[model samples]
Target: MNRKLWAALFLAGLAAPFLIYPVFVMQLLCFALFACAFNLLIGYTGLLSFGHAAFFGGAAYVTGYLVKNAGLTPELGVIVGTLAAGLMGYIFGILTIRRQGIYFAMITLALAQVIYFIALKAPFTGGEDGLQDVPRGMFLGLVDLGHTYHVAGKPLELNLYYFVFIIFCIGFWIIHRAIHSPFGQILKAIRENEPRAISLGYKVERLKLLAFVISASLAGTAGATKSLVFQLASLTDVSWHTSGEVVLMTLLGGLGTVLGPVVGAFTVVALQAELSAFGSWVTVVIGVTFVVCVLSFRRGFVGEVLEKIRTRPPGQND
Candidate 1:
């Protein structure tokens, strides 16, 4: 059943760009991957991080700088960005892994704020203007990512779109593999009962730190790809509000469920895009939608559907 669903999703993704604006679809893919990375921590490891934008936005700046100023290839830029985010995560994990609950969340948020300020003041980042005009660069020294092709009578950046798609798939696959591995089970055990996990001789701190780094790196991958997609990296990418947005995406999609984040990301992105004409009023609509979802579907959209399936009467095909 899961395989079928994954196959269907892959088909849909392949066809989506032809039907929708390629850039908008690419943006959605990036955010979906971002939300999925966040879920790995909060949903699987039971760690609530309130500053994921540090990894997401920080990696964007790194990738943007490298691809634009240093003239690194797109692939290399993303790799370096991912590694940088992982290193940051390792340092952050060392400092905050000992704390739990709100303390942990607050510590993460504070650290993220520091990154935000640094980006704001750093001359290379263009300050409030952001790192703009970030060239997409060559892909493997073969295809020009900046070049566009006419597809089905529409201008489509097929090269860049495919590049982003490949990155998204790789990142998504890593998260899926992590969630299903023995390490992931231990994470689940830790999430269920940390005391019991420790009693079982599990090095809980090490495991949590590992999880944090993995999540941060994947989030960084999403951000790096996003920078290439939009050709810009700004304060908005690293802001606290972006962090909150990911939280909402994870919750609205069904927290621990594997497909929840993607679904939630789609809904939120679609709403924002469609409601853009409303200007600042868009936030009000999103807030109202979130409240309605919370009230009507406590388990989240996908979570509620899964619950129904689980509780259905045996042999009832209908």
Candidate 2:
């Protein structure tokens, strides 16, 4: 209900690896953070840039390259990816801000298409083969990553789990601050009534640009962390479908709700896990779920449910 509660939940998540399969949960957290970052731009700024996969997947490839070839630590590689995504967002934001409505969305989508092609052709990405064998490395040369071991011949390790959890904490804090800050208030105003905010001297376009950059930077953070966890970065990271997956996440969660995306991410990831036996049918199921969410529950699972609890029909409640 409040930021304090959210902080407590995050601390609890840090201890979650002991209670649950850490790697699976860790993947969920990354996607959750990714969805949250994306929501900042679309939910608050009223801008729908469909090319988010470029930031997420692109960063993954970049981080993988840096860690494998450049001999950089995981943290440094993540920062490099974040900065690259931020720069790309800035350049794209500047160019596309001129077009409003669906044109802006289409422009971003087209640009992201170009990025997908570039990734397809890039040699460092190993062409269709992708970059693999990425070391989890160490956390600032302290923790021992060692090698993943198998218990009874089945594999298990908490290293990647902890790594992803730390990054998720960072992402959560960043989004929390953005939502509670004065800047966030301006963004909300722009979302509700951009013309009025602009008339009041808010520099609407500048605010939008800043939002885009922040969103892209956070998406990049998610991507970079994922690259390390999976020990590989491939074309799948930059694919258009990846972008659509996150959009599904934000919509499934409450759009403006801070923690909703996390819940949505967890549910979706878990569903994917359970449905893995179905092979390609998993995508069809997810697509159906997305459509259902769009048509039946416009406020998203959390947002709508909370609306009822937070509001009462004029009758008193105990």
Candidate 3:
């Protein structure tokens, strides 16, 4: 939340491509943004959505289809994809916003299943194989996203990585602004005590609905950017597994904290990449990690750290 931390993160991101694979970093950024979007609804708004993958994967499919088949530019395709996801979120929120707690979560899960079935049958989705070979296309009819750049005497394919990073930063800034705005306060009020917010004359349902739509739109933006990075949109993106993954990222990072999702996303993504060779064992390891984190660090990695810092004795130095 401080300028110093922001500067440090920016510098780390700038130097990451040189230290690690660009594509991997791009994936981390995408998932980080997605988790932040999810956190907006569940962490701040107290809305537990179980079907977030619908927006994320749906947007990926849409952007991939538009870029590959509809001949749309990369940026335009991503924008349309994000908007489509927001529209879907609006409809879903209308249907489920009245429900509370587990019921709301279940309804969202059901809706996501419906969307999943639609994707399975839709011709554009290519059934199980999903939309493949999605072209990254040129950025704004200029800057070829598929191009590579040389840095430090080594060739780094950073064009797409930088593009995704810029998009992530924009999305992060928007989310940060929203979280600190008056509207965000109302959402938090609704989250803390909906009846009180309603008693105070807040349109609780409307606020929740708006928060839901914004969260979905941002998630969709992440998915769309991911599709460009990988040149593919698959069922894996929309599967229930992905929905769970996003939840895990948010929980691991610390819900309600701005940078929690980023930390969680990086950790989960890095673990998966590192354990790729282990195949099914990777899931076991992640499961164990999740259980440990939940039991030992309930506030999440970043959340717990921040809490310690805030609750530390005055004049005590780390």
Top candidate by TM-score: 1
Compute the lDDT of residue 131 as modeled in candidate 2. 83
Per-residue lDDT of 303 in model 2: 91
- Lowest lDDT block of 10, candidate 1: 309-318
Between candidates 1 and 3, the one scoring higher on TM-score is 1
Order of quality (lDDT): 1, 3, 2
Candidate 2, pairs of clashing residues: none
Identify the superior model by TM-score, candidate 1 or candidate 2: 1
Error of 2 at 42 (Å): 0.8
Q: How accurate is candidate 3 locally (lDDT)?
A: 0.93
TM-score on alpha carbons, each prediction: 0.97, 0.93, 0.97
Question: Which structure is stronger by lDDT: 2 or 3?
Answer: 3
Candidate 3 segments whose C-alpha is farther than 4 A from its true place: 152-154, 315-318
In candidate 1, which residue ranges exceed 4 Å CA deviation?
315-318
| Candidate 2 local lDDT, 57-83, one digit each (tens) | 889988989988888888888899999
